[model samples]
Target: MRRAPWIRLLLWHASAAIPVLGAAAAFYGPALERTGGAWPAPLDDVYIHFGFARAAALGHPFSWIPENGYSSGGTSLTYPLALAPGYLLGFRGAWLGLFAALLACAALLDLCRSLRRLLEPRGGPGAASSRWVGWVGWLAPLFVVAVPLLDWSWFSGMEVALLGAVLGRALVAVRRAELAPPARRPAEQLRAGLLAALLVATRPEAIALAAPLAVAVAHAAGSLGAAASLARASLPTALLLGAQAAANRAFTGEWGAAGAVRKLLLSNPYPTPLEKAVEVIKNLAALRVQALESALGGPWLSLVLPLLGAVAALDRRSRRVAVPLLLGAYGSLLLVALNATARYQNLRYAAPSLAMLLLAAALGAEALARRGRLAAGVAAALAVAALAAPSAGFARQIDHFARASANIAGQHVEVARRIAARAPRRVLLGDAGAIPYLSGIPAIDGLGLGGYRGMPFARASVHGVPAVVELIERLDPAERPDVFALYPSWWGGLADVFGRRVDAVKIDDNVMCAADEKVIYEADWSALAPPGERRAGVIDEVDIADLMDERAHGYAFPSPRGGWVIGAVLPGGGDGAGGGGGAGGGGAPRFDAGRLIPEGREQSFTIDAAAAIARGPAVLALRTDGGGPIALGVAALRDAGGEARVEVPERPAGRWSEIRVPLRDVAPGDRIRIRSLLGTFRSFHVWLLRP
Candidate 1:
């Protein structure tokens, strides 16, 4: 039996995927160990996510405390947020997020090559198709592994990248199997269905991948086999879906609104899914520029790929895979919208389609050009290089994982711990959910995305400040709660809300918990500040939250020119911070640009002088909304020009941190405006304030 050159070619390319995988493994080796980090509720939330999923598997209530011990945010329903939990369980908490990312990259390359294989045999230079797979495999490690390491903080635990790979591979499998016999095609189609289902299970919106797979499935089905094929192919998908449905039913008690799908399954006034999709698209388009920047390491590179992808799709040779490729790309882009953190999403989100399209572009380039070898070689080199650099970085970081745990070891978690310890068993706090979940303290709401939906977040009975005060008054008599950790936003009529029962205490600094007041004040907040570190210097910096982007590591607010984020809007938004966190980033008239405000709207900044300035800039510094996409940055007045937008390292939206700039250049009476960097020129989209 003579072996075909193509099979050997594919096998060789597949075999070559090892070093690329190994390289990726080497770079992100550190994350493979610990689960929790100093960051927000992503990985830990995943722990909570898996806890609920595993609980569903075992038939337990969705509670982070599991048995006892208070926590906040119960039973979060967002399954995509929980995918890491499955990996943690399977990988034994190896933090295989990086691995998933690498796999996704590889999968995209595979998608390109397989599609090439199908197209080449017909008219696209079929025999030479096998060689292209190697380059695709080469890119797997590059984009997935290396690029993410450029910034140590962009570690989103590899969920997006990995799931993307699974999606791309599934598409590739569908593409490769498209030419299968009518008799055997049913099985191939079923495989595609299973792949699509897995993707949906990993991420709720991932059902977008199904559109392209459906195209591929329909393409493969014979006229006579259409009815039977749809049935056969859709069965495995149905089974997986059923499994998710049962899990959803177990937790949420409804089949349609099961698992993480519950969030999407609900009836909304937005009407049809298309409307929801429209809303999602609106949000995505707002961050398109930023998403591109985040993906490419800078803003300009982000612009090139999509533009190039669009161009490639238009090519005559690429027409076959172009529509599906574009659909996948558009679908992938949706993941960045209307949720949180659009920055890094631009990078990971487009990987599946981008990777595929690039490969397809490369394949098309090869098929159409006399310099196919040179063209493919260059493309392959860049792809391999992208994979290699990160793999190298991972090797360097692996040794630091253990050190990372010990170095900062539970420093931040301790805050949540002490407050929970001092408070009563069932006490509630503003951020009780996250604080307790991280510190293992039992606070009010412990559920995250999934569990939190069903939990009591707000009650109509306790809506107003006076009503809240009354609820607090009632609590002592019945709920018997002790401490109250009030976030400033809730601090509103809360005292009035709690009636005479809850006492709203304003701590002088950021430190809290009476138990460690001395240490918290002396050591925690103030102690970290350098001597004379209180100047108005952070003004020159850029804030990405202005762009509705949340994927930042930490903010670098220079000397305290202003200590607090002053909530201010131009005189036109109806005076004061009345609109806080409502339409335009709640109060700023920006922040929520795409949703609540129009594009290209511009307004001025104004602040009240007789108000509570918090002794310095602590109260004067304008705080932006953390609700919209992150990267919501603050741009200080400089050069009398308000055209620059930069990514803010910090994304703490609720807390007021000062932004100080050298006022030497501008006169004392100059009117300065600080608006959200969110991409909207609309006056509504721009938050305006003058301090």
Candidate 2:
């Protein structure tokens, strides 16, 4: 009359999958209906993976758009690879989301089975015979699937669910190895290593979990020396991680993926190390606060359950499992908090970590229940209350998900349709995901996620509009996007300079979009050559504002000083405090982009001025923001060195001006350096001209 072990296992997995599927249906049903049966993901980022998958399916792995040639934009390399098979098998469009959903559900089922195994006793008589234990195991999965954020992540068409599943399996494998006899530990260790590698491939942050789990596995393999054991347990992970880095380097010219370079604070071009450290600390604090508030059933239960789980780790019998679980859970949370985007998108980055903590809490509850009938009752009450606490938020999460999906469908998808109808060559846009995928148009990501040579764009965007303009101006002209679809508010300067508005799409009641409106424009590059008098004797021009140009000119922020950072002056003089011929005044400056040379700091550029030297009466022309005066130092060093300084007077604030400093006996390899004698000022362009 007793159910078979396999039957119970099957039932538990089925039970766990029911809520996940039900939640998916409840969330996606209204969204699909709202979009008129068109599938739209809750996040635009979902379509990013679809784009990569489609490229991979067409035999171009790692490329977001096949023509873009090798992009490391997809964060989860394995997820797109997983979805690629679906694309090959004819699961296109709406069916793609369904395919992803099935994969997530399968992962959830696997996670449930792993959790149930972790909940059960290792090996002994009557260990598997307890009815209460079986019921608790069944309820644990329900608790996991019931958390609103986890459910949101599972159905969001991202890699969160698969990550959880792989992480759970890896933990189970580590635990099994710990409990195995010495003779059997090596095989278990190898299995754990393989799963850990897969975990990293699924999500690179899984390295935090995998590293601690490796240490735990090594501790268990006592007969093998610690170094050998650690190597054995960690070998697969290191190799896989190394291979990913090598592949990224080979294709993208970066060791890290484009997503990491664009999103992580560590990779950002911070002017100072101290500033980077401060920003990182702030991000970590913010993520922790968010987790405490919304990660569990509110702050109190969130604090209590994890504490109880830590308490359960005191017992030697439970220490083996509890220690590793605790480390992996908290470690994963710490790792994700370092990301700039961790606090956004409903904390999707932290979902896998929360699941691990919840599972650990469930185990702790089971441990408490084993003490006495009173303890068991108390544990049962707490567990049920924790599960019920998230119910209020569950409905809200579902509504948000559906509404977010609707927003993407109405805005990005509609824009894509319009764009496809136009069929322009090489579109440029900030939101790069759904539009590029759905439209089948070759596009450049203005935000740099999926663009060709996107890093410069990413850095330029961070600095401001002037930097973006300088970079765009330097482009080969043929490579510039002919059409642009962008949120005008996000790129007003760029739009004004190069885009002629064609159409716009607006979405209302939006919960998840960068802006309310996305405007389409025909790119007008004529602005690159603004109508102005050409300087007749100009021999060389260097755009000091552009990072690429700065490097090419051997530009350097002088030693023992704070480095200069890229800054921009918008047309109309930014905030509009009028002075002289600045944009805020009666007229706009010819150039509005430059690098900010801080007060009392010098910036130097090496110029090969051989032609200017050969031409009689050569001069150096400097274009600078008119707010402050500057001192120019010229050093001529062909074989011997001679130096001279020239001072320029300041003009009105919020304006730009050109000052021509005559050069006497200037040689071929002369170095030009400028220092702000007054307050910080922007250096727009430097030109060597023959008078």
Candidate 3:
């Protein structure tokens, strides 16, 4: 290692980091990490992507029409970034992920060049230390930019790393000019101004790099050719804005302003913008500690570091340059009161900012190093550690996703094969995160998740029995899928909606809720005697004493929507607080399941959906041992699908009876599944002819 040269060092860096980067990119880095796929809630961020792919293949215009739950309301800024690239490349998240990784790597290499120059022997004014320059060259970028957020740069979509590279090059040009002979300064200025202008194209903030950059470039040109230099620098910004203006003028009535944004950041309900900005501006003692933690990722804690670093960067030339850069960064991050205000600068958001700040800090650290290598090492360590902190969690997080993806990928492949074998013609999917991409079937956006706020998707029950049934009812016949590939989450949530006639023919620990009598069961099992019985007159053998029937017919009782309820029914006591009772004083309902029923999605459960109806009437019918199909309510597990069986102990045997179920029941046309908190669960079964 001691004999290792620059190439060797570079290779070492690549060897150690690339595998980690590749794993992250493949699993969590879908669309380069910005779209969080490696998490439990992967679908929420990039729902529209899968929808757009199949939609285009079918010749549907990539029109403003959005069926995914994404609101296509105003000029949603998350668009161009969110939708445009997918549309342009005819690609989806995974495809984009591959592209993002390459682009970012290229940009990072260029940034390394700028960093090397800043740290080179061209010492600052009054500081002519050759050793200092050498140290600066190597440590500036390593400590400042790349190491801090290098990991993050690999995954984010919309080219943040590329923008970072451009910024790095221009800043390097500035530092290079600072040391150039008086005669060569003008040439340096032109390089800086030109690079700055080009960077503006990557992000809206790049435009601000213009004014100061133009003057700086002209200064490098040696003459007061500031007018011409500024003109040239301004050209890119003008043309870009001009094109937007022309399009905006042609389409809507606004000038270049994208007027689609309507709400203020204060209202978003997450880490409010006011709180975040205050956090960024007030890196006082206590807040400073907090910012340090965010350097790893608290509501984007890392983002504030850049602003604080910019505020703290000293030295005359640095002050001049950092002021404009900081202004533009802050303005771009917080200027929009109503834009798609992404917390782009949180701790992880701080990665690039840290990179930029490192350039200046390297210059400063070199001076400090003169006191002693110890002082310089301490300074660099602090900066580098702060930047690398948030990325640490990413390491743990990436593996968790990689393993999960490996499992899910297998499920997706099997699910796709099953769907292709069964439903061949256009398949409809529920919770379509990676499935549609894995399967080649033309897909319909299930929940409109990608465009959660404005994308138009028919909201139905979750992915369970009822949701599947409801979904089937809502889809067009052409798009009406016979085979439904559902995430266990969706299926589990809506499993109770259909009863229990659901099955797992295609995959184990998985289900196939269909209506085909040949090889499939239906999602709609409401008319079935029991929730999961395939045959009528089947008998489950659990203790089923009190059954609630106040709401009548279905699982509804405590008002609102007629749905299921769960709680420990107080034995011999009557239903309390919005509950009705049956013969054994057990027909009411209580207990908040800690979940709410949102519009567009059904709310069902896999537990014993109990209710106490009047014993004198039909209250104690299938108390515990009604393994046999009862007259009106839910049936035993046998007749419904999934070979589901509910054990009704000798009804009226014990004061309180517990109904034990073996299989899940479901509704017709639904495919969602459900489970209990303990992971131990049984789906509902439906008996078509009242058992």
Candidate 4:
């Protein structure tokens, strides 16, 4: 604890930080400007926690939407609680997020220092410290800050940095005591237990990290007797976790957070437990492959660090702590890998494993340094170079993240602020991430990712069909979004499908819900009107529907007519929709898309007969096998189109209605098409009539 050593350590920490932070600043500078003074994290999920923190700071429990009561929307119980103070002090958005990450990194540096001190075997009878111990000690922290993935995690405003620091601290203390078991400090042991508790509270996943640490701590505390020491080490953790579970159960009616359950329900690949376990192994294997691919560019550096470290840990000098450390790291990783099946999952899932490997490498480097100056230099240089590519990769990643942040601020954040200013409090909306957080209103998430209530809809499988439409249709009447600030593609067709008149306030390109007005518009119907046909308008009905993609607000399913149905509702629509093979309802098949167009909405079909249509007004007609109220709009391809609903006084359930639309209503042109603006008809057709 000499001043010289402390000062040298401080300088080394600062040296490691400057370049990494400089790269971050370089990326964040323009981002800050683009976001209009608010720094946004790259991931929208970060804002979910920020919102929770903001809510918690206001003396409420963690909630993105307080109006909807407590929903375990935040990923970590402790992180939002930790971030609450920053929000109370008025550091909002990316600023608050960065502060939390930086705080964790500081803790990380402290843990690294403690680890270096604990691992360096100071002047034992056979112990010889390496000449490069001082420089090599700083390498771990340097590697952490320099790597893009690790560095970004700290700034991404998640629990990674905090988890790293807490886990690292406990491991360091455990290592110190394991090395000198006779001098087991009860106070240190209790503190490690508390840290472990905090780690678990930060992320339920840390339970895996804690399980091994518990064994090691008990093993090291043998002097105090196993049971007594185990109790001392476990009591605090158990109490903390039990209390959290009780609180969550009381508030959210679930153990842990509903979010985790919801995620598992949504992502779980199999129906049965045994199958799920098998799938989990496959997913972990896949993740391993992905991590290997990522490290292929720097295989020697990546491979050597962990291998040398693991090998060094077996040496008599480092065996006491290194063995348990390696076991815990790998054990936790295996557990995480088994549970993590996200298609987009990456190496961050195995952060603790990586940390353990790095520590082992550091120990290995120290041992090599003990041999000679040349060996130490080579070891340190190799380790540094190994991390260099990742560091550079992360620097570029920061730039990409900055741009994404800017986009979120300009679009989602700005729109959220606007909606908050205009929309009613507690109104439900779709795509409920940033807007709900920024607006301080409850959102009925259209995509089903954020809030717990939307879990069913979020997890709903439309079997490669349109998820948004099926989700909107399935949502309970009470849970339906009152206002939507989503793209036209999301809600334009929704108005027709649901029979709700949705007035959209155009906020740039994204649509804002204007709830007071009962006016509904589905995309720009005029835009969908064939622009003189893509090729010659094929009179094929199936081909017409196939073209309406997200750009066209259309989803395609199979049509019984030896073709496909675009955005059509098929038979067997009930509670078990999309669950299995259809249990058919004894009703005529229906085509459903756009909002539920109860009265009727426009449907367009391309006509190939341009010359025939030009010669005379097209007689637009449809033979409905069953008809109540029928309507059709006929138009030349260039015409604005005209609507005509047939009045069937004797409405019959199973009778054909031969309805006709006049050519006078349509502007003169060749390639004519038809639009069903209002009313219902089971099926339709058109033909050119000589004037």
Candidate 5:
């Protein structure tokens, strides 16, 4: 006897859950054994969500650390809120990750059920009631559960499974709306809207899928008109997304969340629009290639799946469903392409899109089965062939997940525990995941994913150490970090500038940590002395190495012909001791960092001489890295008049040299222009001194 529908649904879920749960066991077994039974999340980023969930459970949503006011760092506002209940129920420490895994498992089961319903034949006079149809329904869910990458995502303690489930549910709702009668269309559209809202709240990129689904709903409205249906289908998502933007702006002073700002290529600074476009295209192309090899099961599946989707779309009966699914799959891939980290963590970013493509392929299989028994057999054979490679590699993926989890445990978690033992007031670090979450210590994310100064810190880190030093010096004393834990290779210059190494964590056979070693440093801020405490006759001092500071002083390289390199450090060491030389002094210049201006380039700085003790003639002192004897053409412009050009003769090479340009008729609000007429040299410090 055939099973009842509910019983069959239960069986489908059971089949899906079996592999999922078994995979979870296989992944966690080795991870726990390696970490001495301390459960470690496969990726350090999972702890970031845990931190946000802990804050939310404590009545402070949107905060990374409850003590720190508000942080828009959590990527998914709803994921953390969903996990908050676990925290409230005392799922602390490793249990919280288990709770997340359980949530993901439940989501995977729901996704499987949704896919079965989506692929099942609808009731009609000639609808296929063949035994093969039932088998297809049973196998579709199993096929989804079988993909190694998707299974890895399901157990990774991230939101990938939840996103897939919500997207699946939304697709089903939209499909129902497409088939429903005009009288019931609005209600189904509303249902889809609510699900889309949930999807967007889970991951903002769901708009890629949700958008086309909204259009599908509007198309289904037919003669009834699209406005009402479109509104019903789009309202919830619009409101949720708008509220999220508002909250982000109110808390973090940015319209986008901290995590997105830190990671998206769109958020990075580009010198020109052409450069940005070229880089984004290059990145997307590379990501698509990677997705084909891994995320889409294999390169062969990439070709076969799209061909199947096209076949389904060409079929008169399946065209409506196939078109929307194709659009959604393409959109999802495009969304993943925009992500800077799309290639990392086993291509987790592409998992949702993979689900979409698989669903479309399932539809194509059903369309083939509708033709004849022989065609049905052919479709079944194709399905097996498509899945063969991914299924074969499942064990290897499981091993990778286990080792990655162990890596996080041995590196990030171990370091966090050690730092926690110190009881430091505030810790600063680049990898802002496990340390803040596991240690429960306040933190400043040097990469800016979990802090209020996200934009400045992110931009400074990209510009290199001199800009970072300037940013650190600008911070209030209270906000400055006391303990620094960072990868020496990643932030070596920063380590040299403001840190004294006190401890280190080294891990072996590391597959996922940024580096094998994470060094802990005690901060040393003595080198950043105030300008007033420096030299007696100094009127104004400009550190040309600091990009933002230089920009603030109207510093620029005017010609496209000559390139400028910011934060250029000289090879020879200077202690960064302040105030060692004046216009004619022989003492070595203390500054060791500068901007390297190429030959024939003009560099200009506008100084407010009103701040000087007396606005008379001043000595323009240039501390430059010694390469060769250099000649510079210097001109001064004042509100009253312009001064004659002064030529600065080349000094000795192979060391740091101070070249003095005497300014005549200097007054308040004067602008100085300096150009390298002969040699390409780095200018370390520019000073205006009382003559």
Candidate 6:
């Protein structure tokens, strides 16, 4: 019996640990500084897990929004669980993720060393150790560390690293049984089965790898062998998944995790099987487009390295061990191709598969070693050159980590602080991750990731405008936001839907709201009739086209605008503050001939009578649809008392109210004001034009 290769294993593992440690320090050191020693993961998704883990640690159920009931917003079963013990110890945040990542790297190194020993047995008959081939296995860990996706994923608080490690262990066990066929070790089979079950629970995508692997391991015994292997793999996997589903159902009133629903919703608006198939194809195309640069490093390396790996995998001596690596890589990629919707961010979806491919590349280099020193050197040179670009990309990602922590994550923390300071009570919010998590508020997640599922704008499509509108619309009255502080530009077409003009106080560069009292638009604006016919300039002289009942003049507007206008009497304000129209819902002003304009587009109105503003500062109040405020500019104005020109800027609410524009020396009866509807407004009403 040969003694254990403890020295060699330790040396190989140490070699791998060096780069991982160095990278961790380089990336996480600055992240610590940026986050003031908390070392929060850069991605928003990381907090999604942290929220769950923190709850779990506190002896509460997993939930992104704790007040919102049991929410299975977390995607991984084991990751949050892994964070549990440490969180119980009061050590939470990126440090936990980083430690998990280090363990995963060490596991990968051990798996590679074990696999090398299996392929080239020591002290066995006719077994001559190949020195260069040994170097390939030793160097393989370096490849794993260098993959850009793996680097970011390790720090992302995601399950990628852990999944790869467990999956590698499972493959090694199954391949061991296959290598010594006809003598199936029940112990190894049981170990492999347990690992496979954990793999499924880890990411769910490993089912692709697990199924094929079980069959391959059982192939020698014909039908009977296959059945046994299938049962062994299937039973444990089924039990774990079934138990999870039952727990999820009991806790959240849903069978699967909320994340599954969110992903499915993101994949297709129509949840039919056929639409799902179409979605997979679309996702595949996107993956292909992004795969070369993001996953495989670049065009040239992606093409060349895989061909070399294929050649090495085909060799008879390397076939037994090589097959599983190739299968793992291809199966993982297929899983990503079918399931992953988000294709960018450099191999995030296919991270485990990349580890497999890296091993295959090393195997290919090993096969080259057998041919000659020159061939091995060439393979090594190409591998190094191919890795250079990703190394640079990884460096940039470190910078991304720091910047995101400072700008995005830090801003969220600050905003949550301000919100807490201003509104001590819980508030409904969009981008529910950081704000609620930081502020300890009970929030309604507009994106539904935090488990508020009544998102009307939640669609399979990535278009955010419709999603946000639907999210806001779907909220229960009780769940309506006090003030929405989201990026308005992201909510496309909202300016059209909400009639684009209201009185608002600008809060941050991104925030604008009326403090619980301002009306965005008059409720009766939708009752106004469409402008009839294209009458030239000031229709009907004094009236400007009847100023009521939708008979307003259409100028500088789109053509054939009768049906283009749609109206809705939006429900009264959720805050229960404003009265619409009149006290008894009578004598309210009607707005008509309103047009929805594209963002950054403006429309103007010219008033011929200078006496319109003769009475003190002329009032030019306009009604608007209520999403928020719209800017109105009044230029080339006049006072009724004399030939005094003035320009006034005003933002009006969703009412028939008037803005008091100041006048120099106009008398109380004298009026002088010009109307120029500015920014994006639903409709402008001129009361003075009434006949």
**Scored by CA lDDT, what does every candidate get?**
0.38, 0.72, 0.39, 0.53, 0.72, 0.52
* RMSD (CA, Å), each prediction: 17.9, 5.2, 16.8, 16.3, 5.0, 16.1
Flag the better candidate by lDDT, 2 or 3.
Answer: 2
For candidate 6, the per-residue lDDT at 252 reads 50
**Candidate 2, superposed: residue stretches over 4 Å from native:** 128-132, 267-286, 370-375, 453-455, 529-542, 552-554, 557-592, 605-621, 625-628, 633-644, 650-673, 687-691
> How big is the positional error of residue 496 in model 4, measured in Å on the Cα after superposition?
6.8
The TM-scores, one per candidate, come to 0.50, 0.86, 0.45, 0.64, 0.83, 0.63
Report the CA-based lDDT of candidate 1 relative to the real structure: 0.38
lDDT (Cα, tens digit) per residue for candidate 5, span 134-253? 566767656676677777777789888788788778878988888888888779889998998898788777787777778778878886689988999899999988988897776655
Once fitted onto the true fold, the runs of candidate 5 whose alpha carbons sit more than 4 angstroms away are 124-132, 231-256, 265-290, 294-302, 315-321, 338-340, 453-455, 530-594, 599-691
| Residue-wise C-alpha lDDT for candidate 1, range 402-519, written one tens digit per residue | 2333222233244455554555554444432334444444443311232332321222111123222222322223332334444434444332223233223232222112221211
lDDT of 3: 0.39
Assess the local accuracy of residue 179 in candidate 5 as a C-alpha lDDT between 0 and 100.
Answer: 82
lDDT of 2 by residue, 355-442 (tens): 7677777777767766666776776887787677666677788788888988999999999999999999789888878898989888
User: Distance from true position, residue 393, model 2, in Å?
Assistant: 0.8
- Compared with the true structure, what per-residue lDDT tens digits does model 3 show for residues 1-691? 3334577458545643454345344545442232234322122123233344334434432322233322222222222343344446655434644444455556665666655555444343225555433444454434433332334433443345666677778777766655567677656655665666566544454555555555544544445355665565455557756775665444433243322222233322234456645644443322233323443455554543453344334544454455555555544433332233233222333333434444444445544454456765664555555445566565544444343333443344345556555545544454444445545555554543322222123222221133324333334444444445554444443333332334343323211122111122234322212222222222211111011111113331111331232212223322211112322323332111112222222323222233222111111122211122221223322223432222222234223323322223323322222222221121122112112
Error of 5 at 622 (Å): 6.9
- Report the CA-based lDDT of candidate 4 relative to the real structure: 0.53
Task: Identify the runs in model 1 with alpha carbons over 4 angstroms from their true place.
Answer: 1-44, 53-136, 149-155, 223-282, 297-322, 340-412, 419-424, 427-443, 446-486, 490-691
Q: Report model 2's TM-score to 2 decimal places.
A: 0.86
Superposition error at 468 for model 3 (Å) = 20
